[model samples]
Target: AGGQYRLFHRADLIDLLHWAARRAGVRVLLLQKVREVVPGPEPLVRLASGAELCADLVVGADGLHSVLRQALNGDEEPFFTGQVAWRAVIDNPTERRDDVTLHMAPHRHLVTYPLRQGRQLNIVAVQERAAWVGEDWRQQDDPEALRAAFADFAPDVRALLDRIETVHLWGLFRHRIAPVWHREGVALLGDALHPTLPFLAQGANMALEDGWVLAEALGRAEAIEPGLAEYRARREARVARVVRAASGNARKYHLAFPPLRWAARTGLRMAGRVAPGMMLRSFDWLYGVDVTEGSAARSRK
Candidate 1:
């Protein structure tokens, strides 16, 4: 939610869903998981409850460990990214605060964003560590472990973590790019197609863009083949660039060298003071992009 609009919690998804449904002619089904997808002359989907669904086209948005993706492209292993993220939302401090604070230290970063209209704060601390097994997001971590990881951080950071009552920690996993994004009538979306690191925070936004392009391509094409091909061709390069940039950023932000880190911070501080719009303008290719317009419009002779 670092965009122009404010951030929101999971509960706000309801309002978003209602708004989306009203604007777009779509249907949403909850608590239903697609167990398997078979792409063929007629695409077939097997539901968790042994139910079957056949559609002219299938798009997989089930996330990192997408079952539909595994069925469509054969199950592939997910690579551990050697990073763990600890998260929790504590009682908002009585001291009035409106702006979000981002504290970056070598090898670790903490970001706090206002939630529930400033009533609560969403805090996420990410650190690079030795490879950890398991990728369950709901797994809880010991508060001591969280504290120990950031023990060297600033006093304010320590104070905030000290007050946390509940927390969850999960290992991040990176995945290799999909060789074949589409097969027959099956197509992949979001993490299913390209799992990116959290450094860039563009994963969700890219998924949203993919959804729009996928639907438009299908709507315009006479057959599923052309639509799926167009969707993959249009998105692969952009999403690949995003993935590489995010991975590079992870390494760049985790510098432990004293002089280098200092110089980096100083440079950003200077940049913030001078030519701030230039920094924002560098991302025009990203934020100013409108996938609905297609790639041809931006192509040069």
Candidate 2:
């Protein structure tokens, strides 16, 4: 899809959000590790420091391994997708193109895009391998190994890889959406409810949508249960569709058979040349709708 989009550093976005939250008088806590969540009429949050607090409603926006998610629904195993990804940021001195560039190969792909006003480039490389690596994103890997994995890539891509002094490698895993999103004044959002692959670049987008929809649903409802129910109902189908689309893209990008690869490449070229806008329009269902406005319209109706 050919559409104008801007990318920002995660830290910058976080800082902006922190400012907005502070202005709204929201309490921001740091390093308060939650050890347990006791759900009931009034949910209790037990901290690792042995501090306990109760709230009328609790929303868990925690990431993949959410303690609150496990408390609401028993732990379910996450299946490794037989793929691992290395992520790194390198200084961009040449003022690279603002657009994202994807270099695809059999069983692997690399995505590079400029970040921080083109001063840096964010690189995410995924390779399908049998070796089991833990799902921790902070685990460092040898930069030489990443270069070796994509040794056959184009010179431009290789140059970017060469600039990587440090990289973090993490195994990709598919986690089913939580069976129970809301119960007993407790609800889930973001990765705590659905952890999707990065192939579609919609993981963070989906989480943002979840947060907006969750707030809208809760704000309008007279009681917590109904609001939580509405939130799940509005989100589940759309998120599931997005997750499936991302998984399908993973297969499309890693075509190994020569004939299939040729056909796929040719099809993409034809589409880009003949009907580029049509191709972009196809994603209107995914990206066009303003969720906030749509929800308000639905409420009005």
Candidate 3:
């Protein structure tokens, strides 16, 4: 609540994670895709390249499409939420703005924020549609198509959309949190366990929390099984709350009734005027969470 929001490029965040892992004597393996994870008496990882590896404990941090998740909780499909999002990063010719700007309209919203020390601008534009394209994040869309979607936006927004040379569009889908977070010696961390919508921008943050809490819990537990159980117990409730909050945020942003939307906006403006930090303070339960609330020594382990 006291600190400012800092955005990170996906690559830089991963680099930092890898750096910390390596510093802690972790052997970081690259380009090795996990084909399957068998969770039982002996945890196993089968690589796509036909190599099998065994470990004491296997933590799956893989994103939306996780094979490990299927192994633990069966093949559950995610249904589209009738929303499609396009994301692109463009060079920041003007590095003056370093905050998130939201352009909200009925059934659609666009979010822009600076990244990479304001050298790059990150754009997220979401639109509600009847049909979903697909949930694959790597699916590319023509810049012209993106432009067409937001052609009616203000000139400044339109101009920024015009600057996009490349963009990826993905359908927003709702995934049920894996009923079982872990099985045997394999634990699902991050999106593998819970995939929240981008509405709150907490997908990565929650995953980071998941990793830290999982590690901290395991380090404190006497046995691997108990550690994993504790990890799941501590995270499931919190993640569910976040998932609901994110969905609710989408509803608030996509309000269709003109009067309702106007009232909501006016109320927010009045609240900001009356209690300057009221909006953010209301989210203290979220941003103020310290998952590592126990022994630091256990965390170091």
Candidate 4:
């Protein structure tokens, strides 16, 4: 893509947000585990410490396994996508790459990008497998397993993998958009509403857009119900499109047949040489969007 793409450490991003929230007088209560959410005229949240607090609106920004989602809608199952991903971050003091690099192979692909002022590299390797693994992202796997999985990759990639001391393995599972996004005064945001595959790298982007649109709708609406209704109505379709695109990219990257993979790679190389900007322009709908102005205006209308 021709547009500017920046990478940063997840911890650094979270720290920046934490400081910004505190500066804005947003009181963030840490370690307050929510046990139950009771939706009604007065939405009640029960904490693990036996404390019950009532709020006007509750936004669920939790990850893939969300408790509030189960309260708003019943429990639903997530289907495994027959793929697993190994993630690791290694020191890259001498490496400086501003752009993401993807090395693709049969039934597998490895993406690497630098972060933290080019002092660290983040690697995400995905492989198609028949066996199932739990979906927890924090589950650790031996570094040797990750290296063995990509033993046939390029020498440069193998050199990078050799530096990995620890890795996390997680199964890629597909979770559909919740049938109901909001009930009473409780609403879902981010992965709680839609958990996307990592192919398009739109999971965080979608969540940020959702927060923006939801805040805009609620701020302008006369009542809570109308605000939440407008939020879901405006977001649901666009998110569904992005999710479908991500899923398509997953299939395109993981073609196992030799001839098919060769053809696809050749076509991509030809496209890059002939019309480099064409590939970037195709993502205008995604990257070119200005949610604050465009989406907010659409919601008002």
Native-referenced Cα lDDT, model 4: 0.90
lDDT of 4 by residue, 191-284 (tens): 9889999999889878988998998889889999999999999899999999999999899998889999999999888878899877777789
For model 1 the local lDDT of residue 73 reads 68
* Candidate 2 wrongly placed segments (more than 4 Å): 295-301
The global C-alpha lDDT for each of the candidates, from Candidate 1 onward, is: 0.80, 0.89, 0.89, 0.90
Off by over 4 Å in 4: 294-301
Q: How many backbone clashes does candidate 4 have?
A: 0
Query: How many residue pairs clash in all the candidates, one count each?
Result: 0, 0, 0, 0
| Model 3, position 21: C-alpha lDDT score | 90
Worst 10 residues of 1 by lDDT: 292-301
Q: Write the per-residue lDDT of candidate 1 for residues 63-149, one digit (tens) a residue.
A: 888876677667787777788888888777645356667777878888777677677877889898886846777789888888998
The list of candidate 1 runs beyond 4 A from truth reads 1-6, 22-27, 94-100, 292-301
Worst 10 residues of 4 by lDDT: 290-299
200 Cα displacement, candidate 4 (Å): 0.7
Residue by residue across 1-301, what tens digits does model 2's lDDT show?
A: 2366667777887898899999999999899999988889999999999999899998888899998899888979999999999999999856675878899999999998999889899999999999999989689999999999999999989988999999999999999989989889788988888999899898888888898998898888999999999999999899999999999998999999999999988988888899877777777888785677876788799
- Give me the displacement of residue 201 in model 1, in angstroms: 1.0
In model 3, which regions exceed 4 Å deviation?
293-301
